[model samples]
Target: MARYELVKRSVALITLTNPPVNALSSAVRHAIAKSMEHALNDPKVSAVVICGENGRFCGGADIREFAGPLRGPPLVPLLDAIEAGEKPVVAAIEGVALGGGFELALVCHYRIAHFKARLGLPEVTLGILPAAGGTQRLPRLIGIPAALELITTGRHISAQEALKLGIVDQVTEQNACEVAVEFALRAVAKPLSSRRVSMLTTPCPPDLDALLEAVTMQVKKKARGVMAPLACIQAVRAAATMPYSKGIKRESELMATLFNSGQARALQYCFFAQRTAGKWTLPSGAQWNNSKPREIRSAAIIGLGTMGRGIVVSLARVGISVIAVESEKKLLETGKQMVIGMLERDAKRRGVSASLNLLKFTLSLQDLKDVDLVIEAVFEDMALKKRVFQELSKVCRPATLLCTNTSGLDVDALAGVTDRPHLVVGMHFFSPAHVMKLLEVVCGPRSSSETIATAMSLGKRMGKVSVAVGNCPGFVGNRMLKPYLDQATFLLEEGATPEQIDKALEDFGFAMGVFRMSDLAGLDVGWRVRKESGLTGPDVDPKNPPRRRQGRRYCPIPDMVCEQGRFGQKTGRGWYMYDKPGGTNAKPDPLIQNLLEMYRSRYGIQPRNISDQEIIERCLFALANEGFRILEDGIAARPEDIDVIYLFGYGFPRHGGGPMFYSSMVGLERVLERLEHYHQAHPDVPHLEPSPLLKKLVACGSPPVQKWREHIKTMHSHL
Candidate 1:
């Protein structure tokens, strides 16, 4: 609803009253339409000022309403009436003016924005273009190029930037409504013809066709499988090429195409999935809403390798004083140099001074004794981590929270080493932690609800999308990765080349294929893990069998590659060959192809040409099947958490909605059939076998992804 009052007796002030964000709900839209009519018809009212209750103007058209049929007054007509009204209308924008909210502002005769206000047309992010005259009117107001950028990327801009872009009439430090009301009073006498945005001509560039083509190519490369950005470009083109009426019609047509798309549904699900991932729950009933997190002002990081240096920078940049430790003076100096350089470069990008004063590098573990928390980022070896934890127990205060930055290690095993097991959790950060958005807060069996909350809160403070996963080997994200990688290597053994497999994955919307990503991450890391696990190397039972490890099928190809000093990009050759050490451009090596041929010949196995469909089905379905196993085992509470992990950490395409959601979209029955088919073909590969949960769900009519937790909750929870 909307509250109407006569400010200064002559100017009618209409304030939207939907709480929190004052989103344009059906009632609010109807109220605005009624208020506008009253203000326009009344002889006493000379002008109108539109604003929202509280600080926020509007978030957008009620996204909740998007799920159902179009109801209430349509936005396009409501907005058109406001723009065509005889009386002068001013928009007072604060907090956020996004999607339909920004579109509403464009129709007003004048816009006054608070200095802290953010504005943008962000419909494309939800996989729909702004269809309520936004595409047509914005280009007419600020020209085509700027409008295209704003609509396509959904990037919010500061009030100062909006002013520079000519999106707002004035920027103010005072209450936006007061400024807009006063400005509206003076605008009543001005010529309304010049202020009407729809009447204005769009500023078309000379190389408009070429400029559009360039953006199209960039969109295809950067966001390969997404459709909204492409539709947005078409809408903008219509605005530049046609009249306002025709452009608005074209914009609606484009929105219709994108609105009902599966991509839109996936994107919208992702928008909420991110919010849901943060709401961590435990079997003991301790959860996000009830658990209070401790305030962390200072922290420490042990070791100064790539992960450690990044962790140090992440803590220090967030105003948390960081104490970085190294085993030796020489190692400490090297880490210090790298940390300082990364911080400076990051600061320059964000236009802030590097927080050098918050950082302290030392060669002693004793320096970390007084810190509130300590994160161990040393080697991934259990013995080494246990020793480090035991030392920290002896040195640090009893109340200190201890964390380890391990991707796939046992948090419980690490917890057993610490005196305060309840406070020992895992804060797994992706490489270059200062940059990656994901932080999997691994909740151990003994980790207190308060401890988990603190880790999750701290990660959020450092600009990370943290998800609390159960303490298990590899946790949620990496735990599911094992089976997926196995299927990929199996394909290589069955005649598909690395490039062909990688192409299938890349075409499916993954930013990097498995082999290429392994090369970038260094092949030796997994090689060491495999060696430690007795899967390969000197510790393995070489006399037993060549391709069988314990009871399951094993691939020794990665181990062989590492044995030859081919440690990926760092060593110049892996699955693909680089130009030199540290080079990035990967070229398929004939040596790898020849090696594969010889290995197949030695095994006396006949190879067949594999179809792209098989590559995608095996790689992706196997990935989802493991996700089901993880859920059944309670390592991941819900499919959303698993999806969020992939989206932020492993470069899983957002349009696919992670593997679990993708499986649901593919139909649980179809996935079950595919897994059965593959497993029947390769009985040696246990990963290809369908998870019992997948079969159970298929038999039970395959409830949607959101409903999967009901079945998973009945099983024992690892959290």
Candidate 2:
């Protein structure tokens, strides 16, 4: 509801009352309409000042209302009445003015924002456009070029930037409401024609077509197949070519098309999935709120390699004093220097001094005695990690939490070796940890909820989207990646080329395809893991079939590539060729093609024609198949947990949601049928077989992704 009263006996100050973000829900809209009517009718109220309770202007049209029928006052006409009022009106912006919130401010005669306020028309991110005259008015206020960028990107800008772009009239240090009230009083007698944004002419560029063409190409390249950004470009084009009234109609028409799209439903589901992902639960009655995380002021890191250095930078930047430990003096110095450089560069980009003083480097385990927590980011070897944990148990304080930065090693095994197993957990930070947003908190059975909570809270402090997952061979992300990666290699053995497989996946909206990603991540990593597992090398039984491992089909192409010392970008060749060692450019190597041909011939396998659709189906279905298995095993709390991991840790397209969500969007019944068909065709490829949970869900009429957990909740939870 809107609270309206006269201020200074002349100015009528109407405050929008909504907690958190003042979203323009139906009731709030009705109240705002009534307040505006009362203010316009009162002869004593000379000017109007509109603001939001709790220091927020508005958060745009309540998106929750989007799924329902139109009710109460519509936003466009309500805003039009606010603008067409006889008395001057000022918008007092504070906290955030986003989506419909920002649109409300645009309709005001003047906008006065708090110095730290953030404002943006972020409807594009939600798969919609600014339908309430935002498309028409923003271009007129800030010219087409600037408005186009903001509306298309859906990025929030600071109050200073808003003032610079002429989106807000003033940035004030004083209370925005008071400032806006005074400004409204002064503008009461001025001609309202100039203040009306709808009547203003948009400043058109001479090369309007060229600008639109360039932005169109850029958005297509960046967004790949998303629809909202493309519609934003068209709406801005309408503002430039047509009048405000017609432009608004075009904007509404575009919004209608987007609102009905499946992409809109997927994006909105992701928004809520992210929120729910943070609220983790356990079968043992431990939950997010019940478990308390200890505040970490000082921490220690063992191993100063790439992962360790990134972790150090992540910790020190957040004002946590970090002691980075290495076993050798030379390696410690090298890691220290690299860490310092990364921190300096990061601070320079953020316009702040590097927190190098908070860092401590040492070559002894004794140095971590007093630290609150110790994260061992050593190599991904179980015995080596156990040794580190054993040492940490003896060296660190009993109250300290021990964390392992292993990608897929057994967290429970490491926990078993320590005296404080209940206090140990996995903080699987991705490579280049400071840049990536995902962190998988691996919770072993022995791991206490407080330990898991602490690890999660610390990851969040480092600006990561942390998901608490059950301990397994590869946790959630890496475990599912095996089948996906295997499918790509198997496709190659059949007939698919590296480029063909990559292009299909790229067109499907991955940042990079499987082989390209492997090349970038270095092929040697997986090769080492496979060799250690006795899938290849001298440890394999001589009687074992060359194409089979543990009674399942195995592809020896990757091992053969590794034998040639083609360890990806580091060695200049793996799945693709680079210009030099460590170079990023990936060119298809004819040598790899020859290698595939000879291997297929030696195995007496006939080459088959592989379609792009088959490549997509084999790779993605296998990937989602593992996700189903993970759900069955209770490794992930829900399908959204897996989706969140892909959305952040992996480059899963936002419009498709994550693989689990994508599978649901594609229809679970269809996924189960395809898996059954593919598994029947390739009997040895067990990963292609659908999990029982998938079949069970399909049997139950294939419920939506959100409801899958309820059915699965009847089964035992792993985490």
Candidate 3:
């Protein structure tokens, strides 16, 4: 795990040999401890330089070891021994030094970082504080304020930033190991007392109490119920007030508190879940590692609306030439300017020149004839999409792949319109595609494995967390949204106001409640979808009872709101009122409250009190219930894929895991019972009923979310 040798006849070079990120596994830690001992005991060694073999410094603790018992020398004492060594020890940081790795660098007498290197104490992100003298040493090296920000946020800083903050002694453009070795040679005769960070007094601000209080408030407000940041703040406070010995104890205590916490487990599960989501698989045995993805040098986007414009920016920034199409000349010009401005601003932020020269805007399909792939981002109408695909089949070459940016429309139906049904797939990019990290690669029944692979790879290139999902209405993210949204509206009808319900969900860790999210997303979108489905408006049979559509109970409240031209933020009114059209600040509107009261009176139904618990159970349980059904239906391959979609596409809280994991954490038996109770109470609502998969899992002893795919193996698979 580690290699040691003498260089310059006086300096010992210790290089960590672990491949990839050189995570501090038990073996690697043992190796490091032994190597340090040899360097310190050797009479000829005057100095030591430590670095990773493959340019990357340690990424952090081996998370795989987290589930096992500690088997090697403990990190804290090992790091302390190195810090107290008689020989000067220098850390040569190259690609990254994070978490325990950053802690490793902290204990060294000196640090030299490559200009492109990154460093951070990101233990807080995993629901733990830095336990290896990081909280104590960092506050002493940098001031309390800067240390608090870095430790609390777990944000990585550039080598230059590390230099400015005194985290690293120097940043070099050349090889960091060479620079560190030279630095270690010159430091052999220097006093080591001042070089030891833990010995330095923490730079205290005058208003220490107030500053700590302010940061505490900010953390609480931003993260809500998250525990790690709060613990990090407390650790930093200890470093500011207590001796190093006491401060480090406090840090360890904080880490212990977080290490076993459910929140910590959830965060760690999320970390792995994100990585697992990338390894897509199909029933045909074609998977991520085996399937070959075609190289996309150039692509075309149909329609130049919000989604299309964002798609263009996403492609151009990644060095792929994009041809954006529009039906009208005026719309084409407007989209052209928007795409250019967005690309330029994005480039400015990234410190790179805009790739605007790669973009082509036109009102003709002929411009896309030679493109490698064509993503139709027109309106989410199947007929319109079909027409576009038909046109593309005629315009583009036979080998070109065709993709649709439809959120819920049928991918196979659109495939049927093209000559290449096997090439047609869904690239469902979330709104503001350039910013959102999620892309659902909807694999149609006819979609070839190669086509799916290409879309997934392209999504990765665009900096998206793409999950390959089977073709179905709404795919994974939005398909499950139906029940969730239904439960929220039903609560509103049962006397819970929008604010009350939104408050309950937001307190439950959702960034926004259903109603508030709907307002911002534009209520007209769902309203139009409902109308098109004949659930409301002229298409509905007048013979059917009011508030009842087909066989199940329906909420006409949204339709009524839309009828009044309330289309959410864009119209300055929806479930809540805004200051003006295009405004964001949403306040409860009296008009909505009055409408609800009149609707209740007209139906001769009594309004009842609804508890926050009921709101959460009904809404979230319904969401998870749909996820179980999706799993049973084989639309999603695993619970993790569904969770990833929610995490990246939707704003599911990280600490709670995703809906599927949350359901498992809540205990499947309890979920099934609650769902059964809800179903009995509201017999007219089908969504409240527990799915068979949930019942099966509960009967099978409610295994962990990770084990769910084993049970789902017998079910028919779409991907």
> What are the per-residue Cα lDDT tens digits for candidate 1 across 356-467?
9999988888887888999999998889999999999999999899999988889999999889999999999998788899999999899999999999999999999999
RMSD of each: 1.3, 1.4, 1.3
Best-to-worst order by lDDT is 3, 2, 1
How many angstroms is residue 27 displaced in model 3 relative to the true structure, after the best TM-score fit? 1.8
Query: Model 3 clash pairs?
Result: none
Which residue ranges in model 2 land beyond 4 Å of their true spot?
none
* Model 2 C-alpha lDDT per residue in residues 1-719, reported as the tens digit of each score: 88989999999899999776889999999999999999999999999999999888888888888878999999999998999888899999999999888989998999999998999988888888899999999999999999999999999999999999999999999999998988988998898999999999999999999999999999999989999999999999999999988999998999899997888988888887888888888898989999999999999999999899999999999999999999898999899999999999999999999999999999999989999999999988888999999999999999999999999999999999999999999999987888989999999989998998899899889999999999999999999999998899899999889999999998888888888888888888899999899899989988888899989999999999999999998999988999999999999999999998999999998989999988988888899999998988989998889999998987888888889888888999898888889999899999998988889999999899989988888777889
CA-RMSD of model 1 = 1.3
TM-score of each: 0.98, 0.98, 0.98
**Candidate 3 residue-wise lDDT, 1-719, digit = tens:** 99999998899999998888999999999999999999999999999999998899899898878877888999999999999998999999999999999999999999999999999988888888888998999999999999999999999999999999989999999999998889999999999999889999999999999999999999999998999999999999999999999999999998889998888888888899999998988888999999999999999999999999999999999999999999999999999999999999999999999998998888889988899999999987888888899999999999999999999998999999899999999999998999999999999999999999999999999999999999988999999999999998899889999999999989988888888899988888898899999998899999988888989999999899999999998999999999999999999999999999999999987999999999999999999999999999999999999999998888889888999999988889999999999999999999999999999999899999989999999999999
Task: Indicate the worst ten consecutive residues by lDDT in candidate 2.
Answer: 709-718
Off by over 4 Å in 1: none
